[model samples]
Each structure stands twice: as structure tokens, then as C-alpha cells.
Target chain A: MTGDAQTPALPLHLRAAILLRLLAIQGVWNYETMLGNGIAFAMEPALRRLPGGRQGEAYRTAMARHSGYFNAHPYLAAVAVGALIRAELDGVPAAQIDRFRTAAPGPLGSVGDRLIWAGWLPLCSSLALLAYGLGAGPLAVVLLFLLTYNFVHLGLRIWGLHAGWTQGLRVAQALANPLLRQGPAHVARATALVAGVALPVAAHALIGPGRVLLGSVLAAVAAGATLVTLLHGRFEGWRLATLALATFVLYTMVR
Target chain B: MGGDILFYVPLAVLGAVLGLDVVSFPQAMISRPIVASTLAGGLIGQPVRGLTMGVLLEFFALESLPFGASRYPEWGSAAVVGGSLFAAIPDGSAGAMSVAAFAALVTASIGSSSMVFLRRWNAIWARGQQRRIARGSGSAVVALQLAGLSADLIRGGVLTLVALVVFSPLNRAIVGTFSMSPVISRAVVVAVASAVGLAAIWKVVRTTAGARWWLAAGVGAGFIIAGTL
Candidate 1:
């Protein structure tokens, strides 16, 4: 706790380096170490300032320690990088640091998966699909997705770094922020509504007035099939659809 | 299929970058099907057609979470392959979307395996450097990271090249000799895609408390808009 005051702000260049390296933090992911290697790689720039410099014992120990098993959502992993760097610099006890690393990934992974992957991503995607349904140009739709999605993506990375560094071992506090806690549900609701709106609009646009009745019938059948598969819970509708496509293609080629 | 083979090189390159975006870097959903496919289509001066392929593929892609260490489809490179193949066909080809979707799904499965291979390869390489990494050698960590990235890039490129080379002609062959009526073939494809898409939306809607009503309302609104249109 006293380490918060003791931990000096990471220099601008070091912070920048950490940010850049965080981009590739999942590059070396493996079952053994998960994201351990990437965490060390991202944290190295900061660990350089440890008492002995890059070749110093402190730097080496911190690097090796961080290079052990770890995992987190790739985007939110920046928080771990920042917090770990601070903990190392603050000279938090070695045993405590390991515990922190172990405890951290759960919240980071769950929150990030819920907020970004499950909520924000689907929301943006359906919105883009909605735009396409409403006859938005291709470029416009793609741009809308990239621009809107990345706005929060970049902000999360930057905010995560700042929060992690400043809060050090207490960085879990950052995850508790209302935006992180409640964002997924709110986004999910919006996504459902948007997706519902988008599907029919897109269907109408694609099928045109002449085939409206046919399109509706097909949609109804497809929906029924999907619901049956969903009830089964083990199988995915897309996989079934893919199998059907392959079967159709093969049947046509052979016949 | 008749376009210069050289065209595939750049498309493969684009695939590598977008594929890298999948989990390696800047996961800016530019790797999403809509973006990846559109880019591939734009490369061939058929952005709209690419967009069409992208939307269909996006339905399938929604099932992917890209969550921790899960073996999910690599939509980025796959979408590029699908978009490019679909765009390459002359307009009004009944089987174009179907063939492209098939190709993309196949490519995605390949991408998933390649990712698993890359992780295994990385594990071996990382194990080899375990000593140095433990010694806190910055260079060792950097080497592992860079090597892993480079390998992923190559994997994506090769996946794209193989998909394009193999599926391009196959797509043309199937579309050229298609037996199904255009309306029926397309209707089936779109209906299936819609089903998968609706299922994806429903997966989320059902899990979230009280979201179904909003979805129902949205559906009603959608019908109104469709009626007006």
C-alpha cells in the first residue's frame, strides 16, 4: 500500500513502449504460459528501470517472475502490464506479487469478455448490419463499425494503462467502475433491439417486394430450425448451416 | 478465376495483416467479416459485392468469441477469401454467395488449426528459451514475441493464398454448373444465414434478463419499416 506513494510515475518513453508492446501481448500465447511471455515482453520496458537496469538482478528477477503463467483478455491485459510494472517497482513482496498475478486475470478476463467481446462487439456489428439493411453504402457501413468500435477499444487500452499504473496492486478497483460493471447489460439490450430491427430491414432490402412472402416463409423455417438446435445446446446453428452448405455443394457436384 | 495470379499476393498480404489483427495486435475488429470482406472486395473494385459476402459471413462469425485460448474460427483471413471469391464472379451468379460462404467456412477451419499449431510451435520455442526468459533476458522475451508474430503472419498469408488458389476455380466451377434456380439457391443461403444470425442474437438476448421484449419491439418496428419501404 505504501508502494503507491513510493512508485514513481513511469517515464513517458517507457509508458509509450509498454503501450506499443501491449498491442502484441498475445503473440506468444501458449497452454503452458498462456500470456506469461507476452506480459514479460510488454513489461520489460518498464522493468528496465529496476534498481540494476536491464542487466541488473532486480530487472532479471522481475522479468523472469512475470514470464511465468498468466492470462487475461488481450485488450484489458494492459492493466496487468501497468499494475505488474508498478508492483515490481514498488518492491511488493515476491510472494504477494505472484498472488496478485494469479488473482488478477479472473476479473480482467471476465469483465473484458463480457464488456468488449460479448457486449460492445455484437452491438457495433448489429448496428453496422442495420445500416447495411437500411441501404447504407458499403464503405459507410464498414467505416461506421471500425470508427465506433475502435473509439472505445483505444480508450480502454489508454484508460487501463493509466488506471493500473496509478493504482498498482489495488488495480482491481479500476474494474469496479460502473462503466465496466454495468456496460455489458446495457449494451446487450441495445444489441438485441438493434439486431431485431436489422434482420427484418435487411431481409426486406435483400428479398425485395416481389419475394416478400417467400422470404418470410424461409425466415420462419430457418428460425424454427435454429430454435430447435439452440434447445439442443450442444450444437451451433452455423455449424449445421455450414454442413448443409457443404452437403448441397457436394450433392450438386456429384449429381 | 481468370484474373492474374499475381493479384492473390496482395490479397494474401492483406489477409496477413487483418489476420494478425485477430488476436496478435490492434484487435480493432477491422478483422471482423464486414471489414475484412469489404476490403477484399474493394481490392477487386467490387466493394458492394464483397459487402454482401461479408454480411452473410458475419452471421456465422457472431458465434465466435475469440475468448481465452478457445479454438474459434479466424474470421479475418476467411472473410477476405470469401469476399474476394464472391466479388470475382460476374454479377448475378446464383451460386456465388454460397460458394464463397463455403470457401470461407473451410478457410476458417484451416485458420483455427493453424492457430493451434502456432501455439504449439510457440510453446516449443518458448520452452527452449525458458532459461534465458527466467534469467530475465529482455532479448529472449522480445525474440519469442517477434517470432510468434512473424509466424502468425506467415500462417495467415499461406492460408489466404491456398484458399484463393483452391476455392477460386472451385467457386467458378460450382457457380458455372449450378443446378439450382437462382432464387431458390440464394433464398436458401440467405435463409440459413438469417437463421444463424437470429440464433446468435437470441443467444445474447436470452441470456440477458428482460432483453427479449426489446428485441420483440425492435422486430415490430422493423416490420413497420419494411412495410413502409
Candidate 2:
């Protein structure tokens, strides 16, 4: 609190470089380690204040936490890092980052946990499978997948970092602020939107043209109808089950 | 074992890369399932299958955001396993894809737990080397980083190899049993696909009520597009 306000902050390029390197401390090569590393990074400052006062304790803590976080939520960890780096650069105070580290975990974790684990992963992978079933090359599939995922991920990173540095946590707080009032629905919706776009793109690319298209169309209709019915409270587990059975039967007969 | 080695080597490499990326490198592009799995699938000469696996894996991976030392699954390795396994199977074998997906799912579950152990190990390693590291020696840093990456590589490689070895024969047996009945085979595929869908829906349903619609939209759109094609 006593430090000069005008103390030469880390240069933008240097900050970015440091951020990038810090991010690489564990690397995003895998989810488990990534979470551990991310958590470690997020908690680096706090770890520095711990009893040992070791020289590289912060980095080690960051690395460990990175693995921890990655294990729990790989995709969301990418976004959280985006937000964390932003908060750091903005000089919103290390305490704020700590608060976010504490507050954001459970809620965001819940939203992220459910969306990725239960919803998007299965859906997108299934579509990719459907495409493979149609015979697309591996390069094309990989390329497309990379393009779509990075589009969102890199975009979030850049956006989060920029906002955190320029607007500070005030901006991030504002963006995430609604969560406090609106609950987890907002995150769920955001996740759905992103996953929604991703799923069809992969499916369309994979399925190509043929009866596969027909089957997909029928499936879409049923899913849409089921969603609407559920929204209206008219959808029961039995009804949904029946719809699934019928869809399978129709697909079988037609194919 | 020949194909198994080929399959697992890439997965191990991917695990190493992703494990590094999680905290070591901020490349911010490769670790994603879409990219990782597709690459794996391509390496195996089945990009489409890899991509499909990536998409599904992406959903499951959506929640991963490393805020603190909390354990999460390594989708990068998991995707490689899922994609390669699915791609290895003959095209149009939905049943095979399902089994592969299940295999990957199980691997990821176990991987999540192993990550926790690695974290504690890393902490201990760091604490042990504190004095040397503080004195400007880079050995501790290098050792810690290497330890994480090496462990990940071993984990991914071993998991992929074992899962493929175990599941491939099981899949063959299952398919062989149902070979005569296209209905059963196709049914199995649909059932697996639905399970995947249900998993996704369950995630959406648990959080925001609104996500159910989005989930439906994605599924519906996918279904339509696939149908039209």
C-alpha cells in the first residue's frame, strides 16, 4: 500500500512475456497437470507470504495449483488463467486475485464441471464420431477442431488479459458480477452457446451428405421438440425416453 | 501390440505437451481436445474420428479452469486415447466408437486422481530443494518441470496402451457376437451416443435451466445437419 503509484509497472511486452512464461511453467499439454499448475500460479502471491519465504516458492505453488485446477476443469482452467493474468496485470491488488481465487472456484467449478463433463464433451465427441463415420481425413478433422476451440480459447485469453490489465478487476468483476445475482444460469448459458456452435460444426463437417443428414435432421427435430417440451414442463423422463426410442427406431428403419 | 505402440506413443507425447501447457507453456492452442484429439486421430490416419472424439471431449473439458490447486482431468491425454481408439476401429462401427469413448472416459477419471498425487509430490520436491533453488540453482526448477512432464507422458502412454490392448479385443468379441444382427450393433452405437448425449444434458441441467435449450439446440442442429448430409 505504501509503494509509489507511479512505480514503473512491468512493460506490456515484458508483462505478456512473463505471463506467457508463467503460463508455460507447467504447460497446457495435459489437463491434470494444467490444473495443478494453474492453481499454483493463481496462488503464487499467497504462497510467497507463507511461513517458509522460499525464493521460488511462488512459482512452485503456482505450478502445483496449476495441476490441481487442470485436473478438476481443463477447459475452464484456460479461461480462468485468462482472467487471472488479467487481474494480476491490472494491479487490482494481489488480495483481489486471492478473493477471486476463493470466490470463483466453487461456483465456476460447478458450472464448468457440469457443462463440460455432462453436456458438451459427450455431444461434441459424438458428432466427431459421426463425422469419422463419414470418412473425413484426420488432418482436416484436427485442423477444424483446433480452429474452433482455439478461436474461443485464445479469444478468451486475449480478451481476459486485456480487460484485466486495462480495465482491471472492475471489468472482470462487472462481467462476472451477474453471477452473484443471477446464479449459475449465466455460466450454463454461456457454456451451452459455445458448445452448441462447436457441436454442429464438427457434426456437419463429419457427416457430409447422405442418409446421415436425414438421421441428423430427425434427431435435431426431436431434440428441439424435447427441449421445448421440457421448457414448458410438459416433458417427463418417460416421454423423453419414448422420443429417444422412437428416434432410434426411425433411424434404424430409414437407414 | 504393434498398433498399440503406435497409438500410445502419440498419446504419451500429447500428455507431455498438455501437462506442460497447463502451467509451463502458455501456447494456449494445443491442449484443447479439438486440437489434441484431432492431431492424434490424424496421426492414426483417421482425422474425422479424432475430430469427433475431440468435440465430445471438449464438452467434458468445458469446466476445467485452473484457479487453485484443485484436481481436474487431463483432457489432452484423454482425448488422444479416445480419438485414437475410435479412429483405430473400422469406420461406421458405432459400437466401436462407443467402447472407445467409454475407455477414454474411464482413463480420464483415473487420470484426475493421479494428478492430485503429482501435486503433493511436486510440493514435497519443491520444499526439499528450496535452499538450492533459492541460491540461484535452476536444477530444482528443471527437475520439478521434468518430473511433471515425464510422469504425464508415462501416464498417457501407459493408459492408452493398456486401454487399447484390453478394449480392442473386448470390442472385437462384442462386435463378433452381434455381427449377425446389424440391429444390435447399430443399437449399441445409438445407445452409446445417447449416453454421451445424456452426460452432456446432465451437465447442462445441473447448472442453469437455460442450458437445456442450448444443449437441445446443439443436438438438434447436429442431428439435422448429419441427416441432411
Candidate 3:
């Protein structure tokens, strides 16, 4: 045990500095991926076209630089930075940090990107929209969006960097799996519930008394019927459209 | 006009918070269009308009997720700018909101480039600190952290200032080009807003039937709420 080398701990300031550097890196990377010609998009296609030989290996190595796994999530990169800085400050060798940087980005970026962008973001934003439609104030809507989005983003980044790839992958997988499978279904159910509630609520909130409440009650009943019709598979796109049109006409005539 | 500075402070703060959300700070909810634009709108005195702007921005922002070193537009900042402008202007003109939204979109594009520059700057700073950091110097560590914060603050503040000044006058000019028609203006707003909602739903629909329900509910709810308000 005495003969084994000890790992170095990074100082607090160093960790902060490195985290900032990582943020810069993630931000620039994200911008480039979006505005540039998207080398990552082309990599898979180009890889399939390559003949098997030394040329393929060389192509593979070059492709590694633009690899989807490495370039994907920007948020998780912060965790890697934190980990590296911590390692360095604690007397862990610079080489170890370098190795971790090289290895961590690919896996974490791949998983984190898919989880945050493809899964959580869409889900949360959809919910926020639902709330907004229900007459939630702009402040409430925005605050909820920020609260949900940042918690996931920053939490993952910090955890990934500190706990390393394994923990990050586990966390991402837990959340993302549910999203990929049932997120859409849940969104739909929630949306219907909100719609049913909102029509009446909005009428009450915006329009005062009498006819407004009557109109809202009628609309709510109609919405409930539509949901049931939809669930029963009796309502196709055209039918739903017709129903909406009829509702609009009825609402107009009544008002 | 001196009172205008108060308006600008919140706008600047919004920019800073959103910019931080993009990379430096907690990645939580700040980037969402609903959150960012509404906050901007509230700061400017029109919450409903802000919410509307936020929804449109959110739709357009569907494609943006910070992955790696890619050059993506900063949607959070862009939405704030767009939302604030739209909310501030009266409801009778399409051109004002259109110009402001377009300006914000363009500003986001430029912001992507600025992010790239900042990255390179960070890399240079890191390289310079390699030896000192390797030697475990505490002073070098503090300097680097301070540098990053200062850079971010300046980046956000400057971007917001430039966008507000340039787009405000541009919005007025654009609005002046045509007689303001309330019906036509509202029509334009509704069209843009609907398109955004539709686009977002389209993406969600590809995943599950639930998205369709959500979409229908969202649209119906929005209309009802807007009508009531």
C-alpha cells in the first residue's frame, strides 16, 4: 500500500476554473454543431462507405474526433471538467486527467445529449405549454420551465463530472428510458386533463359571470366527449377537425 | 428617458441569467422559451404578449440543444429580445413584432459565433495555466475562475445592450412602413404562433399518440385563455 502512488486532489478554485473552461467548451461545441455543416451527421454515412483496410482505420481515427458520442451533450462536459480538476488538485497525475477527458466526453456526451435534448426538454416544455394554456401567468410558466430544465442540466453536469461516466450513465438511463417509452403517452393524457380543466377555469378567470360560465361548462363537456371519442378510436383526424369546427361555430353563434 | 435605464437593467439581467443558463450556471429552466420570454415580457409590462412570444420562440427553438462544440443560436437570449420587443409594441402592427423577432433570431446567430470565440479564449487561458496548475498554484486558479465570470458577464451585457438599441429603432422603422391594421396584425401574430405550435406538435407526434392529445389540448386551452383574457 505504501509503494502505491496517491491520487492528487484539485483545489476549490481550480475546480471552478476548470468548470468554467468546460462551460466554454460545451457552448462553443454546441454552436459549431448547429451552425457548421454538421460533420457528425455525415460521419455515419461516410463510415458505411469506407472499404475495410488501413484506410478504414485511419478514417475511423479521424471520425473519432467528430464522433457522435464525444460531441453530443454540452451539459455533461462540466462534470468531466470538475472531475479532472479535482483529480489534478488532489495530486492525481496530469496524465490521468487527460485520459479521463479523452474517455469521458464520448460516453457522457452521447447519453447526456439524448437524455436532456431528446427526452427531458421536450417533455418539460410540453408540460409548461399546457400550463401556459391553462392561464398560468407568464412568470409562473417561465419559472417552471427554468426550474425543471436547469435542475436536470446542471445536476447532470455536476454529477457526471464528479462521479464519472458510470454514475452519469446510470442516472441518464433511468430518466431517459421512461421518456423514450411513455413520455408521449403521458403528455397526451396530461394535456387532455388540462384542457378539460382549463376551459372552465379560463372562462371564470377572464370572463366574469353568467353566460361565460355557461359557455365554459358547455366547452368542458365537449372537451370531455372529444377525449372519450378519441380514446374509443372513433375519432380520426378528419372527424376531430370536424368536431373542432363545429365547436367553433357553436361557440361563435352562442356568443 | 432616464427612466428607460430601469427597463434596460432587467433586460440585461435576463440576458445574463439566460446566458449563464446556456453554459456557466445551473442549466435548469432558464432556456425554455416560456420561461425566458415571459420573464422578459413581465419586465417590459406585457405578460400575455411575453407568453405568446415565448411559445413562438420555443417552437423555433425545437432544434437547438447544446451538443459539443457546435455553433448553435442562443435561443434563451433570442427569445428574451423577441418577447420583450413584441410585448412592448402595441398590438395593431405586424411589422414591429416581425422585425423584432427576426432581429432576435439574427442576434442569436451572431451569439453562436461569440460563443465560439469565447471557447477559443478559454482554451488559450487553460493552456497558459498548464504549468502553474500542474505546480498547484492557488493564485493561478483564482485568476482563471474570475476571468471566466467576468467574460460571461460582459458577453451577456454587451449582447443585450446592442440588441435592444439596434432592434428598437429597426422595429419602429419597419412598423412605420405600413398603416397599422389591428385585424391584419393580430392575424399575423396568430399565424406565427399557430405555426410554432404546429411545428412543436409535429415533432412530438412522431414519438407517440399522446403528443397529439397534448397538442389539441394546448391549442384549445390557449385559445380559450386568450379569448377570456
Candidate 4:
């Protein structure tokens, strides 16, 4: 809120640099604290560029601060990075910045996990898979997956940077904006629409019609319905594995 | 059996690069099963086989979320094995492709286990750098981070090399010996994969607004179109 309205804010090149580093958030995965070093790597450039409060001290302090047990869904980690940078520039205390770090991963992590990992990614990949099953070329299929996923991927990073820079801590609210809230549900719906149409078509493509085709269709529905329960019920993955074993048994008997 | 060093060396390089991209480096997501498998297939002059493998592998890949400290298979290297094995088979039979896919799945499992070791090594490396990192060692922080990155790169390359060395022959042997009705086998794979895709849809829609209505309309429209034509 204190910056010059006319100063054009953080330079385009710097934002680009920060985002580039963020792309490797899991580069240094560790069993004890996954991405611990990767967080320092991503934050180093921003800490250097923050432009206030004793640059060297800020650099060391920020690096030490972010290196402590930091983890989040990679795509939304930008929001945390942006907010931390904005806080440092605004002259917020080191202790408070640590508070911001603590505050960050919960909202951003959950939203990110739900939206990116569960929602947008599956939708795009499924769409690409459907296209592939329908006999699309590999490059075209890869292009589809990249274009769709990265549009949101890049857009969210850009939004997080600008919003965090401008709004500081308050940008956490923006993380829950309808785009994250409703956008995922909509993508999921669209995926269903695509899957609904593609399922039958792909069946015909992979298996010629007959009693076998009818059985495949029925099994597809049954497996889909069963998995809906497994996914929704919060059952462990092993349960699904067991169900899959059962499915294999049934598949053999039915055939 | 080893007649094509020319065929495999470049594929190994491709595997290394994509495997690194899975969790390190640019992460342009060329590492995802769909793209990586396709690229591996294209490299061996079998884009269709690659595309076919990519689509199948993608079903399992899509099931994973890969969020926050969670461990999951590194599909990038595994898909390379899959694309290459399927393309290697001269006839491109469905039954043969299924066996190749099984081998690739096993490779993916091994590759991910290797990745866990790399993660543990990263932790040790980072802890050693913590003192300098806290005391304003900018170079130290950068060095430690890069070390982690380099380790991941090496880990990926090694995993790819091992999977290829171990599985390539097994894929050939299994495909050569396995004999079954192509229709039944293809039906099983296609049905299971389609069911996985559908389950993903069902998970999303059931949670979203008016999910039931949307599901009804979608199925109704799809069937109507199918029945009419």
C-alpha cells in the first residue's frame, strides 16, 4: 500500500526470474523435510532483490527463514514466495515473516493440492488421454496437455506475484478467489462431459462390439462406481489395491 | 538381441532428461507420462506405439496427486521403458503390448524407490550446509541447492540406465512367450483403463455442484447421440 503508484512495481525480468526458480521447487527433495533446500533456492533471488532492510542481512535472514521445513504444492508455492517478498519490502519483522511462512502452506497447500493436483491436472491429462484413445497424434496430444495445464499454471503464478507484491499478507484471501474455488469444480464437470462421450467411443475403438463389449461397458461402470466410493470414503490406497485385485478376479471369471 | 546400440543410446539420453524433469530442472512437464512416453516412442521411430503407451500409462499417472512430501512413482522413466518396449516388438500385437506395459510398471516402481534414496541423500547434504546458510553464506546456500539438483539429475539417469538394462530383455521374453486372445486381453486393459478415467470423473463431479444433474445430462446426451447414429 506504501509503494509509489507510478513506480511500475517489481520489474518484469525479476518476476520472470523468480518464477523460473520456482519451477524447481522439488529439485532438492529430502525425506526428513522434502523441498527444504529447494525452498531456499527459490527464495534466494527474491531475498536479494527485495530492495530494503539491510540487503545482506535480509538475504541471510530470508534464506535461513525459508529453509526451515518449508513444503507446499509446487504450483501454488509462488503465492507464499510473493507474500514473503512483499513483507520484507514492507519492513515486516523477521519473526512476522516466519509467521507468514507458517500461515502460507495450510491455505495455499490445501487449495493447491485440491485444485492443481486433484482437479486441473487430472482434467487436462484425461482430455489428452481421450484424444490419444481417439487416435490423435502424439505431438498434438502432448501439446494439448501442456497448453491446457500451463495456461492455469502460469496464470496462477503471475497472479500470485502481482497480488502478493501489492497486497502483502492480505493476498492470502486472494488465494481462495473463485477461480480456485469454482474453477476446479467446473474443470471436473467438463472432464466428466468429455469422459462420458469418450468412454463409449474409446470402448468401440479398443474392443470390437459383442458380448465382450457389453461386459466391458458394465465393468467400466461398476469399477467407476466402486472407485467413487473409495476416493470419497477416505479409504487408504491399499483398499483400492485390494478392490483392484478383486476386479481382476472378476474380470477373469466374466471373460 | 543387442543389435541396436544406435536405437538405445539416444533413448537412454532422452530417458535421463525426462526423468530429471520429473522432479528437477525445468519441469516443463515434458516429464508427464503422456508426453514422455510419446517422445520416447517417437525417438525409436514408433510414434503411434509411443502414443498408445502414453495414453495407457496416463491412466495410472492421473490417479496420483503428488502433493507435499508425498511419495509416488516417477512415471517419466517408466513410460520411456514402456514406449520403447512396445515399439521394439515387430508385430505390435495387443497382447505383447500388455506384457511390455507390465514390465514398464515394474520399472516405474523401482525408479521411484531409487528416488527415495536420492531424497535421503539430499537431506544429508542440506543439513551440512545449514550452518553456512544461516551465517550469510549466499554461495553456500546456492551450492547446496545445486548439489541437490545435480544429485536428482544423476539419480534419474542411473534409474533409467538400470531399468533399461534389467527390463528390456524381460519385456522381449515375456512378449515372446505370452499367448492369449488379443480381443480379451485388449478388452481387459481398455476396460480397466477406461474405468479408471471414469472413476476420476465421478470423484470430481460428485463433489461439484449439481454433479448429479450434470452426470445425467452428459450420459443422456452421449447415449442419445450414439443411439441416433
Q: Rank the candidates by TM-score, best first.
A: 1, 4, 3, 2
Clashing pairs in 1: none
Q: Write the per-residue lDDT of candidate 3 for residues A156-209, one digit (tens) a residue.
A: 655655543223222234334554345436544553444333333432332222
Error of 2 at B170 (Å): 5.3
lDDT at B71, model 2: 59
Q: Give DockQ per model, in order.
A: 0.66, 0.22, 0.10, 0.45
Q: Please list the Cα RMSD from the true structure of every candidate, rounded to 1 decimal place.
A: 1.9, 8.4, 12.2, 3.9
Off by over 4 Å in 3: A1-101, A154-255, B1-10, B134-138, B193-229
Q: Write the per-residue lDDT of candidate 2 for residues B147-186, one digit (tens) a residue.
A: 6556655655565556666656765655444332333433
Which regions of candidate 1 fall more than 4 Å away from where they truly are? A2-7, A208-210, A213-233, A251-255
Kindly list the per-residue Cα lDDT of model 2 for residues A5-120, writing each as its tens digit: 34334356644653453444453233233344434443343234333443464434443333343343444443455455444333345566666665555544554444444433
Question: After aligning candidate 3 to the native by TM-score, how far in Å is the CA of A99 from where it should be?
Answer: 5.1
Name the candidate, 2 or 3, with the larger TM-score value: 3
**lDDT score, candidate 4, position B15:** 79
Per-model TM-score, in order, reads 0.95, 0.59, 0.60, 0.87
lDDT of 4 by residue, B1-71 (tens): 25455546777778788888777776667788889888988887888778777777676565555666666
DockQ for candidate 4? 0.45
Q: Candidate 1's C-alpha lDDT?
A: 0.84
Models ranked on DockQ: 1, 4, 2, 3
Task: Give the CA lDDT, 0 to 100, for residue A254 in model 4.
Answer: 51
In Å, residue A45's CA in model 2 sits off its true spot by: 14
